[model samples]
Target: MMGFGLSIEPQLWALLFAMVRIGAAFVAAPVFSAVSVPLPVRIALSGAIGVLVVNTAHIVAPPEIFSINTFLAVAAEALIGLALGFVLQIAFSAPMIASEVIGMGMGLGFANAVDPNSGHATPALGQFLSLLLTLLFLAVDGHLVLVDLVVRSYEVMPPGAWIAPQRLLNIAMFGGYAFLAGLLLALPVGFLLLCLNVVVGMLSRAAPALNLFAIGIPASLAMGIVAILLALPAMGDYMLVIIREALAAAPALVLG
Candidate 1:
């Protein structure tokens, strides 16, 4: 403390405590949480944001770092951070759900690929749609919006204060939105594919000798491609809406 013009202990402690929230948020966040994102990068980014938080917000670290109160405070910070990120994660899953419905409708459900972002096997169409959503999310500055929500959340929950149990219940309740949004997103293509399937069924019954297996797959595949292309604009627009709604919902978790 003597060597430096100003004391660093208090400020440094606050910065470290602030980083805990930012890091937890990033760990659960989408783009930032990708398997490809390195650990050092996450730490660096969280640390950078934490500094901004310390400068602007009054984040006082616990006086006794080893006390039970400090432990509770850290847990609270992590809980708030997780809630903020998990809300967006739920929204992002809609694209995967929509892809699943449309893929099955188009007979592409068997085609699977590893999603580079999540490193999990998903239907090929799901992978494509998820990537599109990710790009659109970045194009619309969603990551920055999410970050802003995280920063402003301090005004709502602050550090060391436990989040209300009802808010956690609400976050859990948001799980249903994904299915509803996904079905809506898949409706257009799915409806058209349904018509095609019905027509194929009629054809199969009319010509008993005609191998339905050979004809059905090709017909469904070709029509599915066409249906997807036709529905592209609406899907893109819906994705933007999803992004907006997801961002809008995030504030509700922390703010009144």
Candidate 2:
């Protein structure tokens, strides 16, 4: 059966083919990739996005449905999608890394809980920053922006076309940026904690009879909490900037 002189079968194939990339992107993306996100929901969303792409963009179906070329095309599609999502994943990791440094500095490193995103045990502070980052991600409708990039990516690098080597280099470069960003994010609180530790050390040297653990532990914990509260506003702003910059860089890797 044909609709308006167009075969429905080919369109269905194109739709299915489109889903390969969309599905892979969802699997690798941040919020969408969380353990809390159900598999069925991911499938539905991928199908929905695939339908949108097929409707809005012109996609050609492979002449042969079963062949080596088709398998290669599938791999290319997955690669592109993973690269796109990996960019945001790198961005999200900055907060976790920052939390680890701050927690250790404040003697709160042992406080661990399962991360909702990856299901691994993360520092309590890391989890907090991760939640904050998640909120910021939604507040900016970053998911929508990422989906838009996924769609636009088809236009720039269609299925079967290889991804740019420069984009892979960009991802590697961005990993270094994540470390730098995390360090900067923790700098304020870490600095205060360092000073607190130094003072505690001096006090211990002054009074040998004083129980260093009893005094130093409490002081470090109290000071860490206070430093965090005072530095929170600035840290939040830094996260926002990181989010925006990441969003900005993501499109370049995919579209440009």
Top-scoring candidate (lDDT): 1
Q: What is the TM-score of each candidate against the true structure?
A: 0.96, 0.95
Off by over 4 Å in 1: 1-6
lDDT per residue for candidate 1 within 1-256, as digits (tens), equals 5856347777887888998889998988789999999999999999999999999888889988899999999988988888788889999999899999999988888999888889999999988888899999999999999888889888777887877888888888999999999999999999999998899889988998999889998888898999989999999999999999999987786454
Per residue, candidate 2 scores C-alpha lDDT tens digits across 1-256 of: 4574467778888998999989998888899999999999999999999999999888886888899998888888888888888888888899888988988887888999888779999898999988998898899899999899899988888778877788788788888878988999999999999999899888888988999888888888899899999999999999999889888887786657
Error at 71, model 2, angstroms: 0.5
TM-score between model 2 and native = 0.95
lDDT, residue 172, candidate 1: 85
* Collision count of model 2: 0
